[model samples]
Target: MKYVRKLPATDRQLSNQLIENGWKKIKEPRNFSLAVLFSLPFSYLLGSIILWLAYLLKPTLFEFLISDVLSISFSIDFKMLLYILFVFVYMLIHELIHAVFIPNFTKSKKIFFGLNGLFGFVFTTEPIKKERFLVISIMPFFLLSLVPVFLLNLLGFLNWYTLGLCLINAVGSCVDFLNMFLIAFQVKSGHTIINNGFETYYYPMQNIT
Candidate 1:
């Protein structure tokens, strides 16, 4: 994969060409305004689920979040500095998890990671199958958000860094969660999904025209 300083603009021409090639567009927020509107529910629901399961597995995390993270007095120390740095690094790691699952990423050289405005994202022109794409969309949620919390809770260490990773990534991965649901409900199995910049498309594996 590659990295760019700034992601390129949405390639409408490429989107148009994909349409001409008979690939169909998948559902996506038409604009950032609608994105915000639609993403809130997903973020809330996913965050709730993560927190619910987190405390269920180990009640200490919930207690700590409520009693410590919420009530702790303001301070600037090593852990605080680490948390600050972690917040920035989390975005990169999140996208990297996405890039790793992207089919043929290691070989394709089409995948890229970078900032687009305020968000760090991974982009690729490769066509990915529905089953595989579903994994790609949601893997980061598990690996970055849930796994850290679950593992730490299981091991009996509760710290702000892991919790911060857990909470922030839950909200940060709102779009991935949304896309997973959209693809699961809207697209048929055995099909492939691709995108032209921000415009996504899906086509049957047997009939990629």
Candidate 2:
């Protein structure tokens, strides 16, 4: 719930404590670029699916995009505004969504968020259960990406502007979605995740108890 100029470095003390308590570190890609590169396939696949489903839900969106987006008649300034706003707003919301889902986020006051270049990140040393951590990871996509598309479609207002935002959010969430899958597959049901800077480690809850 606190904003830091920079995310706290991996808490060696916490890491040692967790290890002493029998926590096992989760192996993650060594760097951000590598992680993003590893997740790009998932990103592309998810992006394609979202675009396809949106097309099915409202075909005219695709029609407008193809016919107008490429045409000189489309207003570049307006589209640019929406793009910029979506990036700015979505960046904050995306990190906030992660922060909100962490158990007793405000009470803990350990959750820290900040921007790294163009990307926003949230991290905490709090040990969150596997299921809970997964929720924190993926909530942003559900709230900001798919929900917007459906809500717009429901209101009969689906258009290229909103559709593009949804797609951008979905693509931007590639790393999170991949992390969800990675943790689910690797970490056991009873495990909990502890963050160390951008790194993550997990261990069985019983070990701490």
Best by lDDT: 2
- Candidate 1: worst-modelled 10 consecutive residues by lDDT: 60-69
TM-scores, in order shown?
A: 0.85, 0.87
Query: Distance from true position, residue 163, model 1, in Å?
Result: 1.8
Q: For residue 80, what is the lDDT in candidate 2?
A: 87
Candidate 2 lDDT for residue 127: 75
What is the per-residue lDDT of model 1 for residues 19-120, given as tens digits with 9 covering 90 to 100? 898888877887555766788998998788777776677675456555644655789999888877888788888898899888777877778888877679
For model 2, how does the per-residue alpha-carbon lDDT over 68-133 read when each residue is reduced to its tens digit? 457546466876877887778878888898888887788877778888777788878777888888
Candidate 1 deviant stretches above 4 angstroms: 61-72, 207-209
**Cα RMSD to the true fold for all candidates:** 3.1, 2.9
Local distance difference test values of all predictions, in order: 0.79, 0.80
Question: lDDT of candidate 2 vs native?
Answer: 0.80
How does model 2 score by TM-score? 0.87
